[model samples]
Target: MYEEDAQLASQDWSLHPLGELPGVDSVTYGIVTPGPHQPAGVPLLQAGDIVGGVVDQSTPRMIDAAVHRRHQRTSLIAGDLVVVLVGRIGDAAVVGVEQHGWNAARSVGVVRFTEAGQQHGISMWLKWWLKMPEARSRYLESSAGSAHSTLTISTLTQLPVPLPPLGFRTRLLRTMRLVERRMVLNTRIAACAMKLADAHFVRCVEENKEAPRPAAVIADVGEVVGGMRRSAAIEDGLPVAWAAPAEVLRHRLAHLDRTDQTTWAPPHAVCAPGTILVAPRPGGVETVVSRIPLVPGRGMLALRVERETDRMWLLHELRSRSKELVSTAQGQQGREMSRKAFSRFTVAWPDSAQVREPFARIAVPLHERANTALEENRVLEALITTEFTEMAEQTKGKR
Candidate 1:
């Protein structure tokens, strides 16, 4: 390596073998210190902490306080960097104030930057580097030996990192942080908007209480519909906007995939867009009834609304009764909805078309908002992908 590269070879901002990095320390596990159920004492870092390249401090398991007293050596500080040492290993994050209750173990590591050359921008810079596609390539190359695959501290320390000027690193971190802040604000706004939509829907329903109604009974899958066949040709084809059972829960009509899917041929006729999709098999299982709209993969039912009923109104009604619907499925099939139990399910519907106009007025804005949100997400993903790719390429020559 050239003289300029020598200084950065093993530290932050330098492209050197990670093993040569200064101040490297491996993680020690809490197993030897104490075990769970002893008492809520010290917090423990697990492999799950680095999810999608982010340290979710919320998941750190709490150890007995007594354990902390014994394992003072494993204590972590806010500036320390933690890395996963087990499955999917090598994922790393900077310990934040939120991690005060936590300490590293044998399965984790706490690496500190060398005192002589540590920079404030180093942490965020390293984080951004780790998220780059090139870094992932390096991680996969090092972890190829394991079936579950993991990055070791030794391997991570050996990976090459670009040594951009400290100011540049700071600029990059600021830009990324701005994006993150905006994302959080958007999330809050989206949540509040959704709540407003829900409240409006409920108010409209209550106001129309005196309208003429259709004769249908609200029932769970186990009460009326039977389970359909599970076999279907799964496809990723685009489905037209639909108001199916899933729509009732999602509160938005979106396309379902026809391709990349198994063909679900239910014994009873499949319901149309204005119908409900009930879990015929069961609930509480790791199944996605809400993600299915058109034809469901077996053990499901499609409840079509009567022509006189408004699709949106029926959807909101199902949403209001979601808890009741899911609960009724309990004790049916490991907490699932059975088809035989859903056959008799019915609901009260207005007999006239005029009753649906009110629902239509309330649904228009929601439909627009859903479409807007989906488009915004697609655009954001594209923007992030482009920006990250460009940055990684710019740093490629440095490495």
Candidate 2:
């Protein structure tokens, strides 16, 4: 049985340098002018084209026609393989069909299988080669400059591809394609959840815009507490939960919100449970609230809600209007949030403290649901990564 298998494999095997092979063509990298100097033309390949290892031609851009005549030979056809050379780096995709109007983006290459019979084999080969560890290392090694790193054609031409039997390559591609299809489905599902979260935020903001302001408020964040600082640990330390601004924004874990805070050493301020951990600096387009998560640290910054006040509702209020808090702190090096700035910030309170009760009813369940959905996405991402790693290893063995 072993001898028979060896002969069968031998019959199916072939080897050649990528350049020596006929029909395989490198991609055209060129510049296009927006004016009549180049009329709107061909479908261009972009770095973003390689999402989950497939070409997304859905958002193809048109270049000036004059530019197409300049780089006429680099035309894309159905069998060509497109590989990214910069930015996102090394993502590969197959050209679906000949697109006359489209031009290729910078630092991208195409491999066209000359022989029709060999097209599938070559596409699979290029895709698998791009994913290999050697290819990625070479890509990183070849990147130029201290500024924005880039990979050139010379780097790709020198990449060593393991030559395996056509039968083995085909089998490997088949298995991976199946896994990819499932992963794509999961990705779309996660995207839907994100869309819902965005919509919820929009609705809350609109509703608040229409509501009236409260009469008198006790204190804003700055008056209640000061900044927390922590140090890095070499090995181990007490179970002090350390949080960055990101965690706070993500969980929206108002006063009583809980999360597994990573531990750190001294110098880092201890965030006691109930303290509103805010991001010192806000980002992009109107400094909306920092995307910081308020953690129920081990008793730090706990809220002292009055008899009729709902702490959970207050957390949601802070979260929904985080952008405003961020905007108020704009200035002073665009860095840390000044405690003084936070202290003077105005919060609109409802006419009656009884408003907090109804607010909690809406806030608590939504908060829990958001946390559950986020956890699910994390788990799914991990599962996909593990499956891809194991499959790559198995395929490497076949080679």
Candidate 3:
């Protein structure tokens, strides 16, 4: 892709179409019809399942094994590179050995290249390449002019790829893997911290029910602020983030990725840092926490609280019992949340003097721990791009 440089004028690198590369097999999308969801069935990975640059197995939907068997042609094999095709285009993650038998939805592309190319590790390099900004730009360019942006299989097959010398490619990816491993370790730590906090929240709720206490409505702790309809004009603002729906539903992490931020339209009403938002996803509305300054944009409703300490409790109330939360709102707001519907929802609150404050002491630190890990991962993500791009520019001479 850097062939435009004057120094590379005499370089003999090949820029072959991805499908034409020696190591690539068929590069294609996943199952078109997944049938109905089955509670006990084979997991079907969707674009939504590729969160924070990995295939999060826990977040995928389940389809009958029969449906999965019918879509065997697109079955995910261990080491295959899964690429998001519909939304958040160009997100890619290698299928780990644990995900070998899963099937993917039509919105995800399944690419398998067992380390083949002009070099020994082209598949690994290409997997990381697809996650790079430069490659994302190409994917966006290819999807131009559609009613909705989407990466067609034809464009991906024809996408150009470099054939760097083995030594440079190996050394570059070797360093990259070390950095990536640390990111993943941090991700696991954050996940564990969240799980522990959730467990504590559950225990406290159970213990509170043992004693007869006055009932409480959601309004006791927080206010349900409605969403603002955002437009393209928002891009002119100083601090902006990904569209609300994309930020909330695209991933299953406790913290949102800061690298995805962009300048958007100025806000008439900005939600506080610890506001808890309930937004509509594929099935129903779910809770998401935003640590950064945020505006409650379309398809999102924020639970603005007086104290930041109350956030952890309120977040779990909406998140852990979200099905119950959505059910309460369904009679009034349907699947979407409304102030009227949210007003009627009730949650068991512990006495502030005892349970609530102590839980906060434990939960707040865990939330901070997760935020710290995700923030560091963002820095490492930037470091990866810088190191890889710099190495790529000097690769020709190295070879």
Candidate 4:
């Protein structure tokens, strides 16, 4: 345990096992070993559903009502706090009114708070508390299972929770709420910026849909090359930005701060600005093209466009048609679109400079603005994290 947390533990604040919280109606894991998902039925919330201290219902898997009923113990309701007990461990989010009918997956532990007026404040505090770095470390330490770390219901039940005085709790909740609201607002702004950029890109493509198409293959416009495959034992190398498929999927660039040096790639392997880094075999092939340039690592491919093409337009076009390419990929275990396959793929290239230039002028700025918004959100997130750490330290000092 952290020294600060230990100090807090000795304070006058009451301590209770998580399961002993006053309003907790039920504490249980979700459906155990659920079967294959269906198209339409009860929405199943997984760990991925919990993002930024709220349940995102934007994308959810479906299971039949019978399956949902079988897991009635984990049936979610508004104000219920869902904690991830496996994989991600202690990440948590509150089930909002919109997510009331959802049922969680086995990896998600549901805590339903029955107390009316006070439930919201307590639940919010718990959500933030669990997200703290020290709390997450404690959860991992207590976790069992060698193959994959897991928090069993019994173990979770015994987890310690500090209960400060009602007045202190209210004040702390207010401060946390203010920070949370700003964070959420920043996220929403970033999302809106990206959406606007996407809309503009789609509009540009649609407007030029009827223009005379020039015959060209992907190879004609760019150099498609595979990424470096480093040996597992090789570690010593100059630090360089290395990006995997996951980073590309997030539409973010990899940097020295975020990427570790497993091994360095050759100079040719380094991606230049305006390079299109594509993950042909991402878990979700529908969203494969990265909006940002990045150093592609193994299992990824880099495309450096040599021809005069609008980079943003090319990116959007490839994304728009990614599903088609994914369908043509030939791997049986994990589908991968090889360099050969990508190179041969044909695209309707707009040859007119007049048509392409205007599109680039408008689309580029929108995407740049979107990227700026995303960068701002990242800074805000870091600031909030630092603020939380400082607040925790202050609390310990006061005690």
Candidate 5:
């Protein structure tokens, strides 16, 4: 047992290895050798599916029912805590009510708590505890492997957990549950806002279906500028916002009001507010392009729209036709689109300013609202992090 675990165990609270917990019915890994993926079958949950302490059922891989049956021990149901046992070790998410009848990937571990566990809020407590920095560090220290680290069953079984008094646990659970509920509500609100914007954009486009489509090659509408190759040593550049391909992938501006100047490099391409950013490389699932204008940092491309063009309209149109845009990308490794190719890509251009005005008027506000909700979620996340840190400190001081 770790010294910290011993210290906590010596206190009034009981400390037990995870496997010995009476409420925990089972702690097991998923399918060892999954069969080839299928277009439609049983939903197979992987480590990546868990994001923001919840299972993201969107875009899950599937396997045959036979394979799922073969891995019955690892079959997931609601109330189970799924932990990433490989790569991003210690990341966990609870199998939600809607996520029943799912099976886990080899990279994930399923912790199924008993009815007593549910009554005691074991899953809820475990989810928050596993996310603590100290817990994560301990897990990392026990994990083995070079290129791809993994958590062994033995290591997982030996993991220690603090079992405080039931009353204290209940109060803590209630507080955290309220905060989590708010966060979940905020996320849903943000999603609905974005969906509303998309719907409005579609309606606007459909309304102008009868109008003549004045098409323009992307090159004609804007200047396709490539990002600079950042220097290895950044001892000489001015401090500025730097946007990377990852930020573009996430459809968000990178380093907002950030102070890190080391990543900021020159050619210092300042992408204006209306400019569209494109990820020439293929890796992310969320459209390979975005229009969240920011200073183009490293490994990204920016499209500076012509002054007369409708930037919002263009953004919506690109997003609507993202599949075609992704298909246009060339190259074998990493599959990237060049500036020349981007320049030649053609899109429907609104014939009149009047036709595009409605979209901008309605869509902009909806997007703004969504962005506001996202920012609120970020603030909430920061607060939760602080709370968790303080809680850990207090628990440590109890010794």
Candidate 6:
């Protein structure tokens, strides 16, 4: 490897191989086949299970204990850092107390730590280290070298771990915890706001007795447009934000403030603020309203709702019927929602503006509240990454 290719840290600290770290007991991948999800079974954490730097155990894929037994090597304990080896490769989340004894899916790699490691917070530091911008870029670069873009367990085991002095590492992590706590608080606030909006929508729907009418071009709404595919050539100069299907499907939030991918796109691809974005998931369509103007990537469609008040009403309308949106899908997989399918999907749109106004009055503030929390998180995430980079820089080339 070239000197520049190395993930550098201070010369004062020795770089240890991840698998050989004093705290890490073993490094291994999860089960090859978990079979179908079942009730009253062991919860299995997949690559997608890690969200926002934590394990989202709310709706984990439950597999038979028989299946889990075969993968006893990957059974998780509190503070064991789980890393994604496939789709969303390189993402890491520390196993929490709630998910103790749960197994992992095929695409996930479990880094089991010695009891001493857990007490020393080694797993958590590694998890946060992997999330830094530089670390992520390096991992992405390494994974992109493969045709299938995967990070193997064997490869992960050999990863160089920067060994900062124990005292300094703990102190820095102590401060970083404060930032993480604030982030968790914001996430909770956003989640509560979202639930409130959903409740309001449900109440509004229950009380309404008006007949549903077709959405019109001028009266109530506009047309539904498909997202355009972008290439690397047009994105060589200034960066352009493009929301990919994963971003929408994974988040599935009420409103989107920023996008993940970057590429130049056509005018039609750029969705105006408040435009509803719909993307397909495993069993349903995931929808969110764009808070800023940005381009939508492949497998994404934007619904143009000109009226600000109408935007909130339609967002909940589409979200509530997300499962039904797949009825118009063309394939057996049922994971793609084309523009034709969604355009044909009947939304509970009222022909008169006054009808939607009542629901929007209650829903709009809730959406704004949720979005406000998301915005703060966006800022916090950026700041946290920046802080990580700065902290690392402090140790660079130091004696």
Best by TM-score: 6
RMSD (Å) per prediction: 8.3, 9.5, 4.9, 5.7, 5.7, 4.8
TM-score against truth, every candidate: 0.55, 0.54, 0.83, 0.75, 0.75, 0.87
lDDT of 4 by residue, 159-220 (tens): 76666655666666777777677767766666675566667767866786787667578787
Residue-level lDDT tens digits of model 2 in 93-167? 766654433557675676656553244455766675676665677777777343434666666666655545546
- Candidate 5 residue 376 C-alpha distance from true site, Å: 2.5
lDDT-wise, the better of 1 and 3 is 3
| lDDT tens digits, residue span 1-399, model 6 | 122112222234556778876677789988887899889999999888887778877788899989888877888888789998886677888888999999998789999877667666778778877777766676677776455458888778877677676666667778668878887888889889888888888887776656555453312265677676755555334446778777787784577777645666655566778878888877788888888887777667888878777777778887898888777555557655566656666667664455678877877888788878888888876776776677678767752
* Candidate 3 lDDT tens digits, 54-119: 877766688999988888877888878888888677788888888899999999988876333313
Q: Judged by lDDT, which candidate is best?
A: 6
Q: C-alpha displacement of 336 in model 2, angstroms?
A: 16
Query: lDDT (0-100) at residue 11 of candidate 1?
Result: 40
Q: Which stretches of candidate 1 lie over 4 Å from their true place?
A: 1-13, 16-63, 67-99, 102-119, 138-160, 208-385
Higher lDDT: candidate 3 or 4?
Answer: 3
- Of the candidates numbered 5 and 6, which has the greater lDDT value? 6
lDDT of 4: 0.64
- For model 4, give the RMSD to the true fold: 5.7
Query: Model-by-model lDDT, in order?
Result: 0.51, 0.50, 0.72, 0.64, 0.68, 0.75
> Which of 2 and 6 is ahead in lDDT?
6
True-vs-predicted CA distance for residue 106, candidate 3, Å: 1.6
Q: Local error of candidate 3 at 175, Å?
A: 1.9
134: Cα error in model 2, Å:
2.1
Indicate the worst ten consecutive residues by lDDT in candidate 6: 1-10
lDDT (tens digit, per residue) of candidate 1 on 134-166: 777787777665654566656677777665545
- Each candidate structure's count of clashing pairs: 63, 32, 4, 0, 0, 0
